[model samples]
Target: MLQVFRKFFHSSVGVFAALGLIVMLAMAFAAGDVSNMMSSGSITGGDRVAKVGGNTIGTAQLTKQMQQAVEITRQQQPGVTMKSFLAEGGLDLVLDQMIDGEAQMAFGRKVGIVAGKRLIDSELAKIPAFQGAGGKFDQNAYLSVLAQRQMNDADVRDSFARDLVSRQLLAPAQFGAALPQSAVMQYAALLKEHRAGSAAMLPSSAFAPKGLPTQAEVSAWYNSHKAAYTVPERRVIRYARFDESVIKQSSVPSDAEVAARFKANAAQYGASETRKVSQVIVISESMAKDIAAAVAKGESLEAAAKAKGLSVASLGSVSKADLTIKSSAAVAEAAYAAKAGATAGPVKGALGWALVRVDAIDAKPARTLEQVKGEITAALTEEKRKQALAALTEKVNDDFGKGGALSDTAKELGLTMAETPLLVAKTPAGMGLPAELASILPAAFGMDHEGQPQISELVAGKSFVIFDVTKIIPAAPAPLDQISAQVMADIQLEKGSVAARAAAMKLLAAGKKGGDLAAEVAKLGVALPPVQQMNLGREEIMSRGGQIPPAVALFFGMAPGTTKLIPIAGNKGFMAVQLKAITPGAVAANDPLIGQVKGELNNLAAREQGESLRRAIRTEVKVERNESTIKTVTSTLAGGN
Candidate 1:
């Protein structure tokens, strides 16, 4: 149990995952603007969202990763926004992670280290994607991956190499072996055990403090932490949030329009240049050459192909434009260069191909409206609907700035305004608030003088065209009226705790003299609960020190049925607890529990190994981050002026 907790808690997975996610985000955010994508020398610049070595992590790639991230983030937090999450440094944290990954990879290359194939295979086997229906590594599936994702053998090798290097460099060094029996015992104790004990709550209304501060102490404390009380400079502006799906609103297209579109694009609906051909495929070049030789010797191509282990097959009724062989550069060049029934070269294809014959050809004809009206209407209607949505968005945002707010504009459009409070500058909570609302939060903090409404033109993904800073709550030290009573109550609690301690030894002496536990406790003039048999484990009772106490460790250490006085650590008074029973546990072999334990142990070991590896590499690796630059950027962003 102790080991599992450690593995989950201390694994370097958080770090590596963090790095990968961050790098992906950097690539996404850095490449946000498409206009600058091609001409920009590299995305490592401030304008760049992410960087790898000197390579610009293109916005296109970043966008893809960001979309994936957005989906994952949305899954985790259905209503997370760019503003609220960023206020808590989510974006910054993500950016840092990405940058760390990029830097680490760059650093890895600087050294003469390469991730080994063994490491790649070991890690690749861990991924569920490579598994078959039975959950084991599937060789066919593995080959299919190479075929499907357009990955050659080299691509797979590179992927494996990177995965291994990163994993080796990243595995956390925090994993511990043999989850210290002591820790496991301690953790297990918390669940099954607790010491029987009692605490008297001194009512705040019954006691008071000495030497009240004249606001000077409060002011001093507040001054020392001035930065906390200081409200960051803010901006007041107008902006509307837009939902990305606004582009899909309703727009009915006319039948005439659909018919016209169908007429204009009739060819795209159905067009084909059909062809008929024959092919001979051999496994080897020598056999293919011999087959070609035989075909040229007055021997039939099919007979020659059969003799050389080649398969003679015909392409039945395939579109010439869609011919697999004709579409291939290598295959097409050889096929087109030959006359009808002429022999072509041993043209190897993506799979493998050789000599071919062109038998016949046929062309397709365009269809009438009766044959394609339904499909045309659907396409035309969709296009019209898309255009209508754009117009709707423009109308909404334009109405917003027409000397009116969203509410007033909404009212004009026969819409209703829904208002909500409890919104923070960084995190705009509520389902009504879009995630994009957060992307402009930094800008919101920069708005000057509240009440002036500023609206967004239109941000992609978000469709709302409005925003306005409603209020600003300046942070200040709590008033004495609000805090003094609480402070006085705290002082009284301390006094009560001291009073309780002053009576412990006296109570202990009386209990030793056969004074009833209930009678003696009552003699103190304090109301207490009846004595109950509480057999708490070491961890359980200790964790509840406030209520039950870890002093129970010492209490349990006492002989069964015997009472012992144990001092409370970092608290008031000693407790006399009577022991009831003790239970011990041992690690079992052949128990299903052992497998779970082993997995935890392995993870712990991996973490500790990764951490150790990182430490060793740390001395040799150099890092130079412009933190001041980053902070300044943050401040500049936060402080609008």
Candidate 2:
């Protein structure tokens, strides 16, 4: 059901939809500007990859955008390798996007639609990653992020300018596009239609070859399909864990340190009193006295205030100092001076004359040094422990920077060294490893096995880990001898799949020629499972969690009395879909579904118009591609480990 709905929306809506230049730029800012792309060094001798009008996209720019694309993809698929990414036309897509963006901007300039520096600056300030703690653009953060991305100010500003210009040029084309009601009604009918059919699964296993293939056959198949047997790169990580507990000496605070801390924060340990008050302020002092007199005559403060068309404000529980700042020192003093259940405030406040009712009082007595000794000691110890842990981490990092080993540090610190089995980037099930290790698993996979040992804090200053890659198992085809059994099994399945498809096709032909499906299945003479009946509506198909079975979808797509063959997922078999009947659907005029379909089709129509505008703009600008440089970059990225 959604397939037909999605079909109308798949068309490229210019560079905005294809590249989503602005969205990608925001993502790059948030995702820490894609790391330097050409990690294996430049392959084009710094030549330009493309030229749009007078603007040239150099190798650095193309590769950087390509890397950004890959980084964005890896957010959803973490194990995506650069080689696989480039092979999947990631380089072409990014380069095309760059060319399109440049074309749009150049076309924009010709029409006097220029993105000014202020406009670019405004866009940059909107990115959260470029904002400071005050939620505004910060020069320091902007400069720091630029340095981290290995990009300069001019290049970053140019990127923003191009994106802003592209948006300005293409946005108007799709701004108010909508499909007519007649078209929407026709599309809405598909959702209410229903179909009935018969489906038969011709299992490959049911038609398997009699015997396994010989070793020679397995060798040829293995050689031809080596990628099927390729192993993902794996690593063994050796690590040592340490925490504040290891710094027993420095983490322990002395008595003098505790006493000094206590002395410095003496005000924190002083006696304090707070009062809960119901207060009301009047513009005139005499009015406050009247309210106070009424309260003193057995009327509640809240009732007296309500009679005067005023509301009593419950100041919760607040200290004298807090109340003084909130109201006035006189009001606070008067409230505290009165006993509980008494009305004593008819005093001047910053707002006006204040009348307060003392409802409750909470008093805390001052504690002697001995009473708080343990508490002070614990606090001092915690502070000292954090300081000591930070120092230890710094020392370890320094030692590692100087070529010291994790083993040496582990031995010196008396930490227990541990090692993981050869593992992929994803944590295997049941490993129960530290969550911190899971967080850094991708980084570990990216690290060079021969590089220096690295330290990571597992729990900030409290706990940390020092780890190094112990062994590297590079990805390659598994040895033929080791996987011979698997190869033979695959060969048999391939043979059986061929037979199943032929049988399914023959059945499909017979059904289409108006033969009975039941009779056709019986003619196979192999005692296959009976034909499965299907009576499903569009809503029923959609209710399968959006994963409609191939046969069911085929049945729905077919006309009444028509049949088609659909291959089962996972090479399991082929499905013979015989559409016996189709029930035509009638939609009423006032149905809500019609309105829903119209809204969706309107968005799709808008995108179509936008894409048309983009195509015209691209045609208007001259774009040249350096195929040789692109190919070279592709080869290098695709061949890298």
Candidate 3:
């Protein structure tokens, strides 16, 4: 309930939406700005990008957030274009939301709400992003990720704490119990899924609403939403993107270097102790008591294991460290029931009825130096190769920077210069190039451009680059010859529009009379498969389902076996559908939304209750900022959309 959400929202870390922030963190990484390393710059907008008690938000932070939103949006509509996204106001809205969020965060701090380490750690623990394959907090993984993200422990702790504080302020106001439960449930459904019935749909063709304005109608509609038809300005580009990967073929590691690396990181690279054991799973403690009781009364252990839903495994002997069973106290207690010579009995484990007879156990011993030498050699050699590769890349970049041509460097390094086909500023088909490349590509075609190796900032790594554009192609509209067949098909489909409408109308009338849509299709000599049920969710209701007909989504909300007509005016073909039984899709709502309004509301409540407490602490702290600098920075980034 919103009320329940409200009750916990001001806790500096609530049960629900902090998890969302965590989810967003993963998305931010996938969006390729997980580091957010730059929070100290200015923007184009007159409006300050970040203002916290006059300590302006950093440009680096602003850019990272923008990049994060861009990445997340791309995931939402993968392969979406910048022009299209900008037209939709999608990227601008996302950017504005982020800036607003940062402002609010500053406001929260000024108002005297601070998140503590305990809260930060608690929330971090719950984040699935930190959990490794074993499903526990993985320190190594955390370190590697943080390093890659250019994050330190302190920065993470602070960011996490701030996010928690934000959540504490926002969630409760959005869902507080002062609102009626009905309101909560209503919002819940709007925001979530309901498991129930299936649906079918009726389409516009059936009930052709008569508004034939001749050619005038089409022209009018086009004029109203003319932005949709307007051509996007594009650029012709010649770029040279060069990275080490394309040019370098991996070579086998030298035996000496591999051996060295293997020895240096031997603790990390070597194998682990593995074990084999049998398992018994049960539900209740009482049932486990019963099973144990029976087993202790001279029942065969195999029988006891069989009486329970357990699977047995055989191993000559395996190391204890390798056994998953040994990792648990419950399993350990059960397994250790007997000495090496004896069998253990009806001892309980954490999950269920688990009794272990230590069939065999092997102690882990250090691997001999000779036995691991080859692996070590290989690993060390690879490390050397990586270092060499990195040095080579740096050398090439240095050469490129010092007025050296890509061709010149390629020759000197014994590297081959390869060319990419035309990739205009706006059109990129390669997996490596992103929309941001548009900004960089123009420079490749600008003054003093030719033979000037355009080294780009490292994307995934310091070594990565988008190679030079070998060809520049201007955007072209479909040529007559190329689109002749398509034009003919369009002419046929367009000309048939009147007849199709008339026939579809008759079917709609029949469908309203409870006739099967399939029956109508048969009368028209067109075939369609019988309706099959599918559960549609936010992620699935897409263009891929784009072909399924708009009726797919609209019909799911209709009553079973009923008819409701709708129109599909998009890229996929037009379709008609009848409402089948409503199959309510999913189960329960998991979490609540935390918007800026909700957060502001939470802050007001916090202020009333603990204003004096926070004021006293803030009065003891010192804060100063250069407002002019911040204003200059944030403004450049503002007002675009």
Q: Which ten residues in a row have the lowest lDDT in candidate 2?
A: 29-38
> How does residue 5 of candidate 2 score in lDDT?
15
List the lowest-lDDT window of 10 residues for candidate 3: 26-35
Model 2, 1-641: lDDT tens digits are: 11221232234232122122332332322111112221322333457676666656667656656665676566558889788887677777676765676677668778999779899788667655567776899999778756655657776666566656666777788888988888888888877888887888788888888987987889899999999999888888888888877775756678888889889989888898888988888889777778878887999988888888888888999999899898889998998999987888789888788888888999999988889999998898788777888888999999999999888999899999878888887766437456567755766788876456988877766778888888889999989889998888888888889989888888978987898677898888665778898888886777788797666767777888877887878787887878888776678999999989988998999889978987788778866677887877777677742
Q: Which sections of candidate 1 miss by over 4 Å?
A: 1-259, 271-367, 370-382, 395-523, 537-641
- The residue-level lDDT of candidate 1 at 437 comes to 57
Candidate with better lDDT, 1 vs 2? 2
Show the lowest summed lDDT stretch of 10 residues, model 1. Answer: 27-36
Instruction: Give the C-alpha miss distance for residue 503 in model 2, angstroms.
Output: 2.4
Per-prediction TM-score: 0.42, 0.66, 0.38
Name the best candidate (by TM-score).
Answer: 2
Pitting candidate 2 against candidate 3, the one with the higher lDDT is: 2
User: Which TM-score value belongs to model 3?
Assistant: 0.38
* Full candidate order by TM-score, most accurate first: 2, 1, 3
- Score candidate 1 by lDDT: 0.52
